[model samples]
Target: MATALVTGGAGYVGTHTCVALMEAGWEVAVLDSLENSSSAAIDAVAEVVGRGLRLYVGDCRDNSAVERALTEAGPDAVLHFAGLKSVPDSVADPVRYYRHNLESTSVLLEAMARHGVRRIAFSSSAAVYGLCKELPVSETAATRPANPYGWTKLISEQMISDVVRSDPRWSASLLRYFNPVGAHPSGIIGEDPEGAPANLMPYLLQVAVGRRAELPLYGTDYPTPDGTALRDYIHVMDLAEGHRAALEALVSSAGQVHTYNLGTGRASSVRQVVAALREATGHPLPCREFKRRAGDVAELWADPRKALLELGWSADRTLAEMCRDAWAWQSAHPQGYRR
Candidate 1:
């Protein structure tokens, strides 16, 4: 069987990707630090996939450890998902963010090159397009990251591009993901943030589950229809499947770095998301609308034609499905894996 190494494979997106890869007939090994994820999540993947996961608890920045992991897994490709992702946290500790996000990715790429692992699917973000004035941001949009977290991702994407350019034998797929929400429909795995959730879906889930008092609408003064920020929220499962497509594309292409934007191409405001959550959970959730948030864009979605054309992938899940699955996971695991 072919082998693949998934960095940060125990986290939300990474864990789901592991399941998708296993279903696609790839032997998978996960390397994670557990700083932002739980070992229980890894176990959940094992249970769902009906196979024990090869998990290594370590940092990606550790060059020797990365080398050993590649040597051990003998991965045919590396799904790069290991990085710090909180915008607020990145703002607070820019140095730490750069060290963990940018530096660690650099080390991982070096290790991959040294070990002759040429195929990679990097987990880039929409934040790399930072507050785009355009309505539907595409892969061709200018990359002006608004925060340090996004800056690190932009840097990492460039590094991957450069690596592929320098080595003709290396191939990579840079997948720029939009706002990824929802959870595995099975309710066994989901977005389980450690502290106060940075993203909207997790926060709304907390409110729906009565763990939090109310949802705080971060921006109510934007130029959008609801005067709030809008984002292209895609189901985590769809995002995971997109990873599989990207990996297949890179492996088949074999000579170029391809970029694709993964999203539903539909922008939903904060108010709209909250309303959908209330309907999905069948609860009276309170929402507190406030002033515009710092570093927030009025509207952002994706032009997924490229992905559809190239990878033959499009988000098949709906907003209702996203809310329903998230509600299922939140209601089932209120404390998220601790239960």
Candidate 2:
């Protein structure tokens, strides 16, 4: 069986992808810093997969730590997911974001080169295509990141591309994801953000479970059907499956840098998501309107046809399913993984 090293494997998407990788018969090793995630997540993943994974506790930017994981795990390819992901957080601290995101990738790449591991599947974001003018933005859309977080992703993509161009042995799959929400259907593993969540779904879930008072509905005056921002929210499990497909493609393809946007090809307004969560949790889910946050886009979705065609993967979960599953997880673990 092939082996893979997953950086930040204890985080939200990383944990689910670890389960998927194990189910697909790949030996998995996880390396995480436990900064924004809990090691308990890896335990839950072990339970879900009915097996344990190698856990290396450390930051991705630490060369010695990364090299230790690489040496001990001896993975055939690396699934790079270790990075600070909050956009607002990035806005508040651009240097920290750039340093953490860029340095981690650079160190990891160097370590990969040292170990002769040339294949990687990078976790990118749709934020890289900031302020997209076209609806359902394609892979070829102009990438003009509006925030430091998006700039980090775009710069990382360029770094990977440069490396691949310089060497014929290197292969990469850059998966630009839209909004990833929901949780594992089992409710054993789900998103557990530190402090307040910057994303919408987690905040809504917290409010549904009474952890918070009400949702702060940001910007209700955007040019949309409901005068609220629209986004493509894909289930976390579907996004995990997309990673598996991309990894498979990378294993089979030659030295080429492949990029694909992973989404449901449809947009859900903020009001629509609130309505869905209210129905799912049977909560009134009170909300109060607020001014639009800086760096926020009006509408953003994806034409995920590239991933569908190339990776043979397409997201199939409905918004209702997303909300229902999220509620299942939140209700089961009111205190998150700490519980």
Candidate 3:
């Protein structure tokens, strides 16, 4: 079995991907700072997979720590998911976002080069395509990131591409994912963002579980059927499977650098998501309409044909399933891994 190292293995996507890798007969190791995540997530993954994963609790920006993880884990490849990811927070502290995201990738790349780990699957974001004019954005679309967070991802992709170009042995799969929501069907592990949730599904779950007073539905004036923003919200399990497919492709394909968008290829509006969550939880969720925030896109989905054709992967979960699974985890753990 191939051994893989996951940088942020305890995070939302990271935990689910770890479960997928383990179930696929891959030996897994995790290196996480536990800053925005918790070690309990790793434990939950162990419970779901019926095995324990090797974990290195350290920041990815630290060269020594990364080197230690590389040396100890001895992974054949790496899945890089360690970075600050929040649009509003990134706007509040652009320097922190850029420095932390860039520095973590730089150090990890350096350690990988030193340790002879050439293959990597990076967690990229759809935010890289800022305010796309097209309905379903493709990989060839122009990348003009609006916020600092998106810029960091774009810059990281460039850095990874540069590395792949410089060396023939190096190969990378940059998986640009759309909105990743929901939880594992088992409800043992899921997205547990620290403090107030930044994404839609988690916030909706919180409101349903009574953690928050009401949902702040941003922007009721977008040019959509519901007069709200539309996004391609893919389930977390589907995204995890995409990671597995990307890792396999990276190991097998001859291409040095590959980019694929992992999404459902269908956009769901905020109103639709709210309605789904309300029905799923059987609660009349209260929502407050607000003006569209800056740097917010009106509509954005994915043309995931490339991923479907090349990676042999596509999101298969519906909006209702996403809400149901997310609520299962939220209702079970109202405090999100704390209780």
Most accurate candidate by lDDT: 2
Model 1 Cα RMSD, Å?
Answer: 1.1
Model 2 lDDT per residue over 1-339, tens place: 999999999999999999999999999999999998888999999999999999999998999999899999999999999999988889899999999999999999999999999999999999899989998899999999989999999999999989989897999999999999999899999999889988899999999888899899989999999999999999999999999999988877667999999999999999999999989999999999999987788999999999888888999999999998898889999889976
Candidate with the larger lDDT of 1 and 2: 2
- For residues 1-339, what per-residue lDDT tens digits would candidate 1 score against the true structure? 888899999999999899888988989999998888989999999888889879988899998779889988899999999988999989999999999898788999999988999999999999899879886998998999999999998999889989989998999999999989998888888899988898889998988878899888877877889788889999999999999999988877767989899999998988888889989999888988777777777888999999999889999799999999998888989999856
Indicate the residue-level lDDT of 309 in model 3.
92
> TM-score per candidate, in order?
0.98, 0.98, 0.98
- Over the stretch 113-205, how does candidate 3's per-residue lDDT look in tens digits? 999899999999999998899879999999999899999999999999999998888999999999999999888998898889898888878
Q: List where candidate 1 sits over 4 angstroms from the true fold.
A: none
CA shift at 234, candidate 1, in angstroms? 0.2
User: For candidate 1, what is the TM-score?
Assistant: 0.98
Candidate 2 residue pairs in backbone clash: none
